[model samples]
Target: MSLIGKEIGEFKVQSFVNNEFKEVTKEGVLGKWAVFFFYPADFTFVCPTELEDLADKYEDFKKIGCEIYSVSCDTHFVHKAWHDVSKTIKKIQYPMLADPTGTLARDFDVMIEENGLAERGSFIINPEGKIVAYEVIAGNVGRNADELFRRVQASQFVAEHGDEVCPAKWKPGAETLKPSLNLVGLL
Candidate 1:
């Protein structure tokens, strides 16, 4: 039941962006890549740092045609309130999704029932709405936005060059392995 390689464009979600509520779903992600990040809640310690990091890298993500959405179980009102109070949150230009029902978090399989919050999960979905990559970390750990950027670049490279596959620690302009019988055991 792993969501890997599965398409998730069918699920509709409400996201708070720039102090407004809007619908973001498969259709909204039709023409660009998406980074769907799930944090536990608003006004939390580690969450704010992670979110601020993502905000700092927002322009870079946008340059790659990716839309970022940070989701939590809190309502849009709560998100707005936090944005108003926190200078770190006020710098965020991307959408903050309200998953009060936990439906979206459940769909992404990041919801924790005991704590009633989401795990630190991140999904990199392609423009076609297929989930290309995903990572779920423990609640206490913060995610690396730079690594997320690298992953997106690698995925895009692989998609564009169908015959090549990126190796570990592959960055843009790095060598990619071609899948062939002759290449087996060559490395």
Candidate 2:
């Protein structure tokens, strides 16, 4: 049941970005690197901090040709209101996707049926719209964008060099292991 290598399904939602509202679809995520961050609610305690951290690293993500999308069950109007009132969230230039109907959460399989909210989910997708990495955690736990950036780099390295695989704690310009029978049981 792993979502790895699974293409994003059809789903469209309202997104608030750059003081405007727009519709985002599964097709919209194609042809570019993207991150889908799912959180419980907008005005909660930990969400803003995590979002601000991502915002701080937004430019670095962009440098790697990645786009960030923050999703919640809240409506787009709520996203706008939070964007207006919260200075930390206001720093986010990425789109805030509104999933009031829980469709996106369900599509990502992070929805809590009883709570009508989503868990802390982080998904890294490649240019072809396939999910490359994903993590879902409890609502209280936050995520690190720097780690996500590293994962993205590692994914890109692996994609471009299919013969090579990134080792633990791999960074760009670092050494990658070539998978071959001769190297088996040597490490």
Best by lDDT: 2
Clashes of 2: 0
The residue-level lDDT of candidate 1 at 22 comes to: 84
For model 2, residues 79-179, the per-residue Cα lDDT tens digits are 99999999998999999999999998998899998999999999999999889999999887889988988999898888899778899899999999887
Per-residue error (Å), model 1, residue 139 = 0.4
| Best model number under TM-score | 2
Model 1 lDDT-worst window of ten: 7-16
lDDT of each: 0.90, 0.92
Q: What clash pairs does model 2 have?
A: none
Candidate 2: deviation at residue 175, Å? 0.7
Q: Model 1, range 13-120, lDDT digits (tens) per residue?
A: 777788787887768777789999999999999999999999999999999899899999998889989999999999999999888888888888898999889999
